[model samples]
Target: MGDVNRATTAAARAPKQDRSRATRQRLLEAAVACLAEHGWAGSTVAVVAERAGVSRGAAQHHFPTREDLFTAAVEHVAEERSTALRELFPQGAAGDRRAVVEEIVTLFTGPVFRAALALWVAASNEEQLRGRVTELEARVGRETHRTAVQLLDADESRPGVRETVQGLLDMARGLGLANLLSDDTARRARVVAQWAALIDAALGAPEDA
Candidate 1:
């Protein structure tokens, strides 16, 4: 329902020049990698600056505090994923809705969601990060549900249909967290199958891809 490139990560930096925009992109990507691999404690501004191959002062110039850097990084990466999801879930019913369900499930269980999950865990206790994460999640959640509903061609006019659509995201994220520490492959597959059934039924599609 929304355009991903409309407010890109680079635009978030308000960069007036190509060089400045490049620097912001570098820092954002480095920050996403570090957050996914090392969690919040390891993703300091100095470390992110070093990883981005930029001076610490430059990082500071872009983001005055550690909180600023990570918060912006969170937003930058989310925008990036939203864009990619838009491409994957393009306009039309190319296949059965099960394919769309599986694709969205795969996205939540992948690296981008992993990084965002790490930030969410840390945000629970960290005041500054908590504020940003809370706001961002609300916006992202709304966009994700709207997009998924559109892809499924679901009848949101039906009762509880909108919430059921969002439930796919919640279910996938719960499964993603479970997979982090253990294989849980067989169980995850079952969960995906069941959720796909529920989603397909809601949208009046048969259980076939």
Candidate 2:
């Protein structure tokens, strides 16, 4: 009887745990969408909760403050993006440097990046957000650079290789900023192609070469 009761209690708790996780995920995703579409001034816990189909109280339960919600949202999406990027090249980026370049650029041109940019703009003016945003960006930047290096099969021991990868990311970010107002697809494709060629040259050709 005792063993059966323990098993039943565990089973009952599983659904609740799953629901909590799902709710949290929904709030995070909704927060990102709100930040992307509405900007920092317009996005609030209440608004995100509405978008998430949850209550404001629930959202606050997960994230105590507005900053906590938005920051966690961005970081969560950033991690998801990183995982997606890695999954895109399961075999590793051994030979297809152009494909890698295009994908990396795609990361910046997406809604997640837009949401992060909104946070950045808000952080510039909001004293309370500046420190958290700064720290979050630094961590994200480091992870992105590390991912880029891995995807590009870069050797940092080689002179200027590190800078080249960082430059690629910086250029991609600039392209993302340009994309904020307009499509910029045609020009971006041209730039991506050229950058791929430049990377090939700088990285001394792909492994398959």
Error of 1 at 184 (Å): 4.3
Best by lDDT: 2
The digit string of per-residue lDDT tens for model 2 on 5-31 reads 999999999999999999999999999
Q: Could you tell me the lDDT of residue 180 within candidate 1?
A: 79
- Per residue, candidate 1 scores C-alpha lDDT tens digits across 19-108 of 888998999888888888898878899889999999999889999987778768877877777677778756644456777777777767
Listed in order, each prediction's TM-score against the native is 0.84, 0.96
Colliding residue pairs in candidate 1: none
Cα RMSD (angstroms) for every candidate in the order listed: 7.8, 1.3
Model 1 spans with C-alpha error above 4 angstroms: 1-16, 184-186, 205-209
Scanning candidate 1 in windows of ten residues, the lowest lDDT window is 200-209
TM value for model 1: 0.84
